[model samples]
Target: MSGPGTAGAVETEPASARAGLGGRYARLWTASTLSAVGDGMSLTAAPLLAYTLTDDPRLVAGVTTALTLPYVLFGLPAGVLVDRVDLLRAMRGIDLFRGLLLLTLAVAVALDRGNLLVLYICFFLIGTCETFFRNASQVIVPSVVPRKLLVDANGRLLAAQTAGNEFVGPLLGSVLFAIAAAVPFGIDAASFLLSALLLSSLLGVRSAKPSTRRTGGPSTSERPADLPAAPGSGVDSAGPVSATRPGLLADMTTGARWLLRDRLLRGLALAAGGINLVLTAGLAVMVVHAHTVLGLGSIGYGLLLACQAVGAVFAARLAPRLVRRLGDEQALVCVAATMAAANVAVWLVPVGTGVGLALAAAACAGVTWDVVVVALRQTRIPRPLQGRVNSVYRLVAWGAMPVGAALGGLLSTAFGTPSVFAAGAVLMTMIAACLAEGARRRWISDPR
Candidate 1:
C-alpha cells in the first residue's frame, strides 16, 4: 500500500539503500546523539559555572557572546578547512579537542579555582572547534546515506538532537550540578570521548562527490590521457578531481554567488535569518521572565526550557509528513506563521506558573519551523558546497543572534519582559509574511 511518493517507492542503488533501524546509519546516528548530549551538557554547564563563579548576569551573558564570536570571525575559514580535510577525521579531532577542554574545565571546577578569564577562553576555543565540527557533519551526511534518504537522515539527526541534547542534556546537567558542578563536565567529557571513538571507526567510507568537477581539470577517466592537463595544472594523478585552491574571500564569494543567484535559496536564507533573530531574542529574555516575572526559580526555569525541548522533539517527528502533505514551501510558510502566532500568545498571556504551557506552545512552533527550514536547505543546496553554503547561511542567520540577545536585554530593561516577546512576535510575523509571499511566487516550490 505504498503511496506515489512513499519511502518504499523511491529508487536507490543497492549499496546506497536505506539503512533502517540497527543499521550503519543507526550507528552514525548514535554517535551523533552522544555528541549532542555532550553538547547539551556543556551548554548548560558552562553558563551555570560562570554564574556560580561571578554571580554576575553580565558575565553569564559574556560567555554566550564570546563563544558565538568565533562563528562570525572564523566561519568561512572553517568551511574551507572542512572541505579540504577528511570529514570523519575532522569530526573525531573536534570531539577529542572538546573532550580535553571540558576535562580542563572540570578540573578547574573541582579545584574551586575556576576563573572567569579561563572560562571565557575555554568557551571561545570550544566554540571554534564546534564551528568546524558542525560544518564537517553537514558535509558528512550525504556521504553516509543515499540521496533518496537524505531527508529521513536529517530528520533522525534533528530528532536525536532534540531528544538527547535539548531534553535530556539540560535535565542531566541540572541534576549533576545539584550533586556537584564538576560532575556534568566530567560526563560531557566522557560523551565526547565516546563520540570520537565511534567517528574513528567510520574511517574508509567514502561519501558521494559533487556532480561538477573542480575548475582545474577533469579526472583521467573523464578526459583522455593523451590530452594535456589544463594550464597551471596540479592533479593528484590517481585521486579524484578537485577545484583550484581558491582564496578564503573567493571561496566565500563563490558561496554567496550561488545563494544570491538562486531566488528560492536566497529567500529561504533571508526568512530563516529573520526568524532566528526573533527566536533568539525570545530565548534571551525567557530565563529572566521565568525568574522575576513569573516568580519561578532557576530550577523551574530550567524545567520549562526542558519542556520546550520535549515539544521540539515531537515537532521534528511530525514535520516531514506535514511538509509532504502541504507541499514544502506552503508548509514552511505555515510553520513560520504558527511561530508568530505562538509568540503573540505568549506576549499577551498572563505571567503565572502556567508559563510552561506557553513555552511549550512556542517551542512546538519554533521546532516545526526549524525542522522544515533545515530540510529545505539540505535538499536545495549543492552537496559539495554544503559546507560553504551552510557557513554563509549561518553567517547571515546566526549573525542576528547576538543582536537579538543584546536587544532583548535592553528591551526587557527598558519596557519590561513582555516587550521582548512582543518584539519577537512582530519579527516572526514579518518572517511568515515573507515566506508566504515567496511561496505565492513559487520561489521555494521545487527541490532545486
Candidate 2:
C-alpha cells in the first residue's frame, strides 16, 4: 500500500511502502558508515600519537581541543556554506580533501617527520571540513526520506555510526597502530577515498528553500507544534522573507536569531552544550586513564571503546521504539538521568565490573539522546533553514567540546583521571534535574 508520504518513484515502491527508508537514504547511510570508519581510525590513532609526543595530560588534551575548536569557531558560517552550494558536490570535495590530508599525515608519520604542530594543524583543518560536512549531510536527509520515517532513518544512521566509528574502526585502528603508527592513518585515508566514491553516485541533491506558507499537514507550520511549558518562554512568529540572497553575516544572523527566539530549540541546544562539555571532559583524558588507572595498552583502550559502542549500537536499534514508548520529552529526562548515574558509577566502580557496565549504560543514554533530539530537530526545523539553524544549534551544542577537553586535562592533572568522571556526573545530574522538571510541566510535545 503506497501512501502519499512514500518517497521515490511510484514504480520502485516496495510492496509495503513503509518498509523502505528510500534508496537515496540508503546510499547516504552507506557513505556515512564508510566515513565513520575513517573517522574512528584517525581519532584513535591521533591521540595515541599525541600521547607519545607528550606526557603532559594538558598537552595530550590539546589535541582534542584543536580538533573541536573548529566547531565553535566556524560552525555558524559552515551552515551558510551548506545552504549556498550543491550538497553532494560539496561533500565529495570535502571527503577528497580530507583523504589527501590524512595521506599526507600518514607519509609524514612514516618518515618520522611528524610533529605536534603538524598534527594540530591537520586536525583543525579536518574539523573545519567536518563542520561543513555534518551540516550538509543533516540537511540532505529530509529531502531524501519522507518526514514520517525520520526517527527510523536517524536510528539506523546512528547505529551504523556507532558500529563503524566506535566498534570496527577503533578495534582495527588499535591493531594497525600496534603494528605501525602510520598504518591506521593510511587506512583512514583509504576509507575517506572510498566514501567519496560512494557519495559520487548520489545524484540531484540540494537544500530546499524555506516556505512561509504551510504545506502538507498541520505539523509543517512556521512554529514548532510543541513549545516548552516554561513561563516566559516566547515564540517568535516568522518574519518577512527576503527575495534576494542575504549577505553572509546576515544569513548567519538570521539562523542564529531563529534558534534563539525558539524556546524549545534554544533550551535543547543549550542543554546539549552542557552535556557535551561534560562528556568530552571525561573523554579527553581517557587514554591517560586507561594507561595509568586501568593499566591498558592501545589494544585494551580500543576494546573499551568497542564495548561502549556495542551498547550504543544496541540502544540505537531500540531508540525509535523507546522514544515512541516514552515520548520525546520524557526520553530526554531519562537519558540525562541515566547518563548522570552511569558517570557516577564509572567514577566509583572498577574497570572489570562497574566501569564497563557504566560506560555501556552511558553509551546507551547518549544514543537515546541522539535519536530523540536529532529527529526532533529534523521534524521541527523547516528544510530550507536546516543548515543554518542546525549550525547555530551546534555552535552551542558542540562548541563546548574544546573547553571541556581543556577542563578534562586540568582535572586529570590536578586530581587524577577519576575526577573527570566525577565532574561529569555532577554536571549531568544537574541537567537531569532541569529536564525532569520540564517534562513534568509538559514542556515539549513529541512531533512524532
Candidate 3:
C-alpha cells in the first residue's frame, strides 16, 4: 500500500493493480536491461581503448569526460525537446542513431584507424543521445506503472543497469576485446538495435510532454483536475488536464525554477551533484590507483568495477524496504555514512583486500540515495515539469561530472592518485553530514 496522504494514482492502486509492475513495467525493464548491456560494454571498452591508445592518465580520463560533457552542453535543450515529443519516438530514434554511430566506430576501431579525436566525437555524440534516453526512461515510467511501485520500479531499473552496464557488460567486454578490439562495440551497437525494437512495442504509449497549465494573461486560477500530469512528476499524476505551453525560454527554465525554489529538491540536488563530482573524479583518479597502487590489469580492473556494480545491484533490491522502514531521510543518513566510511577504508585498509571490499560496501550503500531520490522525485514533482525539472536538476547534479573528470586528471597529476581518492572520500563524508542535518531540520518536503 502507498503511504498515507499520497496524492496520485499510485496512491490508490489496489493490490490487484499493483501486479502491473511486473507485467507492464517488465517491458520497460527488459528494454532498459538490454540497453544497459550495450552501455556497459561500451563504457568498459571505451576506457580500455583509451588506455591502450595513450599512456597519459589524463587522456584516458578525458575519454570519460568526453562521454559526460554532453550533459553539461545539451542537457537542458534535450529536456525541452523531450517534453514536447513522443517519449518512445525520442528514445527509439536515439537508440537507432546510437547503433549506427557505434557500428561506424566499431569499423574504425577494427581498421585500427581510430584516433583520440574520433573517439571524442563518438563518445560525445553517444553521450548526448543517452542524456535524452535517460530522461525519457524516467518520464515514461508513470504512464506504465502506478506510483505505489515507483520506488520498486526505479530500483529494479537501476539494478538492471548495474547488472548489465557495470557487471555483465564489462565482464563480457573484457573478454570480447581480448579476441577483437571492435567486437564489444559492435555487440553494443547491435544491442541498441534490439533495444529500439523492444521500445517500439510498448502498449499505452504516451508522447512526452511538459505538464503545462493553460494561461489567460497572468494570475491563473488553480489547475483543473482533468489535465495530464507532467511526465515523470508524481505530484500531478492523479488527473490529466495538462498545463498550457509557455514560451520556449519559459518552458526551459520552468523545471529549473521549480527545482531551485523547493528546499527538499534543492538539498537533494546538491547532495546528488556533490556525490557525482566525487564519483566521477574517482572513476578517473581511481583507474590510476587500480593500475599503479593496486597493480591491476585491464581484466582485473573490469572485475574491480564489477565489484562496485554487484553491491549496487544488491542495494537496488533492498533500498525500497530500507526507505519504508527508516523513512527517506534516515535511510539516506545511514546509507551515506556507511558509504563514506567505506570509501575512506578503500584507502585506509590493506591495498588488495580492502580495495575490493570497500568498493563493494560503498557502492551498495550509495545506491540507496539514487533509489530513494528517484522515487521521491517521481512522486513529488508535477508531471508537466518532470522532464525539464529533471534536466535542470541534472544540470546541477550531473553537470559536476565533467568538472570532476577534468579535476580528477589535474588532481591526480598534481596531488597523486591516492590523494584523489582520499579527497573524494572526505567530500562524500561532508555531503552526508550536511544531508543529515538538513533531514533533521526537515528541509526536504513535498513541494509540488
The regions of model 2 sitting more than 4 angstroms off are 1-30, 141-158, 201-243, 324-326, 379-384, 445-448
Instruction: Give a tens-digit lDDT track for model 3, residues 157-257.
Output: 65566567777777888778777879988998988888778878873454443333442111112222222444333334444443355654676677778
Q: In terms of lDDT, which candidate is stronger, 1 or 2? A: 2
| Worst window of 10 by summed lDDT in candidate 1 | 1-10
| Global lDDT of model 1 | 0.66
lDDT of 2: 0.74
Give the best candidate by TM-score.
Answer: 3
Model 3, residue 45: displacement in angstroms? 1.2
Which of the two candidates, 2 or 3, achieves a greater lDDT against the reference? 2
My TM-score estimates for the predictions, one after another, are 0.78, 0.81, 0.82
RMSD for all candidates, in order, please: 7.3, 8.2, 6.6
Best by lDDT: 2
TM-score: which is higher, 1 or 2?
2
